[model samples]
Target: MLILGIETSCDETAAAVVADGRTILSEVTLSQDLHNLYGGVVPELASREHTRTLVPVVREAISEAEISYDDLEGIAVTNGPGLVGALLVGLSFAKALSYSLNKPLVGINHLEAHIFSVLLERPELVPPFLCLIISGGHSNLYLVESLGRYRSIGSTRDDAAGEAFDKVAKLLGLGYPGGPAIDEVAKSGNRDFIKFPKARMKSGGYDFSFSGLKTAVAIYVSKLNEKELQKRRADIAASFQEAVVGALLDNTIAAAEEHRMARIAVCGGVASNSRLRERLKASSETQGLLVFYPSLELCTDNAAMVAAAGNFRLENFPPDDLELDAFPYLELGD
Candidate 1:
């Protein structure tokens, strides 16, 4: 089945054509540089950028795939759990295309697409596994039993991991998309320079809380002299990154053990961190759990994952009518 996926949930305006979920015929992503200048994403700017770039980007994807609109069996778009204005651009375009082409339209949850990203790489991968989804806007663990099925095992009580990273990086004068910036500097630094507190919930559940850790970094950096701060940038980066990675890995492994699940997967933008990947792999091995992740490029927002998810939903669920609209806060299990 040929599916065209549109994603504009955040700062990226992306479109892709996926065949049978595994094969990505074409993918085009238009990133918003304006957000970087502002130190974070501005919703109004994101929506305007999406409106301007969505059509051309989608056209490029279709052309690159060497396919026409007539060849598509369905259209899939991220419907919610993101900026409502940003999401509307893709949703509106997708609905119009689906209605005009008389193809099935599936509303995909952004978080679900991240989980399905694993299936793109491992076609034989099944559910009943523990999943760690850490992104800019969210950090949650789930027991996934099948497509569109999820049980929330735990989630962040405060700041999401990615949000914490960005905030820490900003405080340190690092650039936007803090994950990469921190990861880059952390390569030469020591992970033990500044001891940051890891928040272990008192409830003894798998839930996470990075807000305290972020605050610790902020406080530590504030006390540093200009000379001391500049001299130990790498060490500070490494230490902060270690804390973030440790928190995620610890909770994820705990979830796997609690659920008695042998398969483990990490998804979303933070999943692209090399440190996180290495720790997850090592921890998974020690725990005797199989670990899965999307290729680095697919780790962030992309259309291929969206289309892959759409294909799964289209194959399993009945078609929806033109009344389907963008859902700003659709839950995963809903």
Candidate 2:
């Protein structure tokens, strides 16, 4: 099926065309640089930006695919777990488009879309595998048995892994989008510079907690003078990155082992972290497990992933009856 995907759950306004979930016909994403000035997203600005760019973005994707609206078999969109206004922009556009085009409408869960991001590249990836979804708004561990079937085995207790990265980056005076900033700065520094805490669940479960680790970073940076902070900035980035990566790798590896699964896929914005990609690859290799991650573009919010996920949903689940609405707090597999 040829699916037109729209994604505006966050600051980015994206649209794409995918064929049968595995083939990307065409895709376009316009990122809102406006958010950078505020060091975080402004929901109002995000929705306004989406409203403005939604038409052009989707038009460009269809034009790039060399297909008119008549060629599309279905329309897919992200409708949940994001700012209500931002999500509404895309959902409204998608629903209207679907109705006018007489195409099937599929509503996608944002987090579930992240998990399916890898499927676009690795079509062979199927059920009976573990997936670690680490992003700005989410840090979850799931046992993906099949399309639309998710068993959440582990998740965050407080701030997500990417959220901690952003918070720590702010503390270090790193600009917006902390994951990339920390990844770049930590390259030349020592990962063992500070023995930052990597919390392990006392119950021996897969659940995670980054609040303490974030507080520790805050307290450590607070003690440093201006000159000291400038001198150790790279070290701080490296050490903090190490702590976060450690917790992620340990939990994922443990989960894979406990589940007796040899294949794993890590997706979402945080999966783009150099440290995370490197460590997960290295650890998976050492433990004789296969790990998959989407490319940098797909790791961030994109309509391609949404379309890719929606293709599966369209095949498995029935299309919505137009009564569907944007759900700002939708859970995966809901």
Candidate 3:
């Protein structure tokens, strides 16, 4: 089936045309840079940008795919778990397209779409695997039983890993979107320069906690003079990154061992982190387990994954109605 996927969950306005969910014919994404000025995403500005850019982006995606609207078998959109106004733009537009083209429409959960991202490149991958989704807004682990079937195993109790990266970077005067900035600088610094605390859950579950780690970094920076901070910035980044990576890896490995799952899939924006990828590779080799990650382009928010997920839902479930509303805080499995 050929599907057109629309995504406006956050600052990105994206559209894509995918064939049978696995093959991407064309995809176009426009990221709003206005968020950088504020050191984070401003919801109001993000909604306005999506309204302005979504039409052009969708047109370009369809044009690049070399298919007319008549060729589309269905329309898919992210309807919830994102900025409400931003999601409404995509949802409303998709609903209109579904009505005009008389094609089926499906509303996809943003997080669930992230999980299906792996299938866009590896369609043959089977289920019964563990998945860790770490991003700016979320950090969660799930046991994926099959398409549309997920059992959450763990999640962040406070700030997510990426959120911590951003907060720490801001305190250190590092720029917005802290993951790349910290990862790049940490390459030259020593990961052992400072020993940061890695939180362990007292309940002995797979849950994660990064708020204390963020506080630790904040406290450490408080005592540093201007010259001292400049001298040890890279070391700070390296040490902090090490701590976050350790915490994430520990829980993931533990979950995989406890469940006896051999395949581990890491998805979301943070999946693009070089250090995380390198560490996962090492762990896979040491433990003799299969590890999978979406391509860099697929790591962040995109419509291809939404389209892929919609393809599955459209096939197995009834089409969502035109009245389908935006769910800003919808949880997975809801």
Q: Once superposed on the true structure, which residue ranges of model 1 sit more than 4 Å away at CA?
A: none
> For candidate 1, what is the TM-score?
0.97
- Which residue pairs overlap in candidate 3's backbone? none
How many backbone clashes does every candidate have? 0, 0, 0
TM-score of 3: 0.98
Candidate 2 on 1-334: residue-level lDDT in tens?
Answer: 8999999998899999999999999989999999888888889999999999999999999999999999888999999989999999899889988999899999999988888789899878878899999988889999998777889889999998888988999999998899999999999888899999888788878998999999999999999998999999999999999999999988889889899999999998999898888888788778999988888889999999999888988988899878889999788752
Clashes of 1: 0
The sequence of per-residue lDDT tens digits that candidate 3 reaches over residues 243-327 is 9999999999989999999999999888888888899899989998899899999988899999999999998999999889999
For 87-114, candidate 1 gives per-residue lDDT tens digits of 9889989998999899999999998999
lDDT of each: 0.89, 0.90, 0.92
Judged by lDDT against the true structure, how good is candidate 1? 0.89
TM-score of each: 0.97, 0.97, 0.98
